[model samples]
Target: MNQELSESLDKSCKDLYKEETKYFDYIKKIKETAPNLKNYKTNKSKKIDQAFESILSYHEEAREVIQRKIRYANEGLKTTNLLIKKYVQQELISKLPGWEGSSNPPPLCGKIPANNNYIASNGDLVAASIPDENTGSAIILCHVKTYSKTTQEYKLVDFFEDLNKGPSYYTLPKEDVIPIPRTLSSKHLSQTEFSKNEKVLAVYPETTTFYPAIVLESPGSRTKKGFDTFYYSLRFVNDFVEQIEVYARFVIPNNEK
Candidate 1:
């Protein structure tokens, strides 16, 4: 509704400006044809100026209203994210291997595993922040292909993808790897259920195949444009930030291929 209203207001402003121009042209004719009524043109111009000022003021107020709505929406989003973080820390990751209700919790504060024992095992899904010239450094979702305890390095493969694919292999440091829970379900990571920077496979527009992406805004309607559509504001692994909006249905948890 806000989008439609904004467009309509803009159209009206243009139409009014066109008519205002025509009015000045009409009065200019009177000035040219009769020199005695110069005061009339001056008074008419003042009235037009007043009307234009009112229109300008109206535009400013409308802009302020939109900005206020944006501020409110952002505040709500911040609160929602805080709640998701708390829930994930309590429910999701808390159930992972090393976090078996132990006194010493897993390394979640910085998201790096403290040691080999704290890290996930082979075939466990993880979000690896590996970057290459092509992928542009966004976190790509993958499953642990292998890990070297001595080197503290992990070999990750794109989640459920073919192992023969050369690009699918991701070698990440212990610090860049985030282990995902083996029991985490699709429902826990869907839309508003997703946490900030959560690993995901979102469908690229006009394609059925899900690709690697990270969550920027979960259940996000591309809110930058004041939209409330069913879209996940995502950044595909290949690009830094571009026109990427995957429908909610197309966005799924990292475990799914």
Candidate 2:
């Protein structure tokens, strides 16, 4: 019976230790990925806090168990507990400063619509700060699903874990969103180079994909005559959808590619 109990205790300690190790590694990643932790509070940090709290509690319980074993003069249990303490103090505690620094959490969602079109009503992507099952928090973004102009309510699009593959229809609240901005080129397009009925490549806002389009109107629909840079309304070749308006800089001349 004593041997069985000892084995069980050892297994439990090792399992908890492994979990703590993962927490420590995650903290390191946060430090590298989110250096200005003070500016961006997020559910990710909250999960880190939960993990830290669990570690502290586990350490305390292990200490009590060790003390009991020592009082009974159980050499094996005493040694095992000492090792656990060493791992907690050395490996886990040493890396906690990085985690402690990430105090600011991200907002629940953005108040305005994201400036780009990749975020369609059902196409925009998003990432939650923590795992889905956990009740922590998340950030949001989009275009078609755009900001609810009438309501100011934003949908949680997806989780950060799936940022690589892309996100589908997942609605989150306004406070839990982080808008991902699209990068625009600094070089402006020349006005004379574009003309009506000219075939060119235009950026499709829905997926950021560039497709062949015919220029239906010069100075794209969004561009004003006096503006140095303008937008153009384009009819994508073979597209059954409505004409899309795009910035001059985003339109690529088919020859350039």
On TM-score, the candidate that comes out on top is 1
lDDT of each: 0.55, 0.46
- Model 1 poorest ten-residue lDDT run: 183-192
Q: Poorest 10 consecutive residues of model 2 by lDDT?
A: 103-112
List the pairs of residues colliding in candidate 1: none
Write candidate 1's Cα lDDT for 231-252 as tens digits.
5678888876664765554455
Q: In model 2, how many backbone clashes occur? A: 30
C-alpha root-mean-square deviation, each candidate: 17.6, 26.5
In candidate 1, how many Å is residue 120 off? 3.1
Q: What global local distance difference test value does model 2 have?
A: 0.46
TM-score of each: 0.31, 0.26
Give residue 255's error in model 2 in angstroms.
3.0
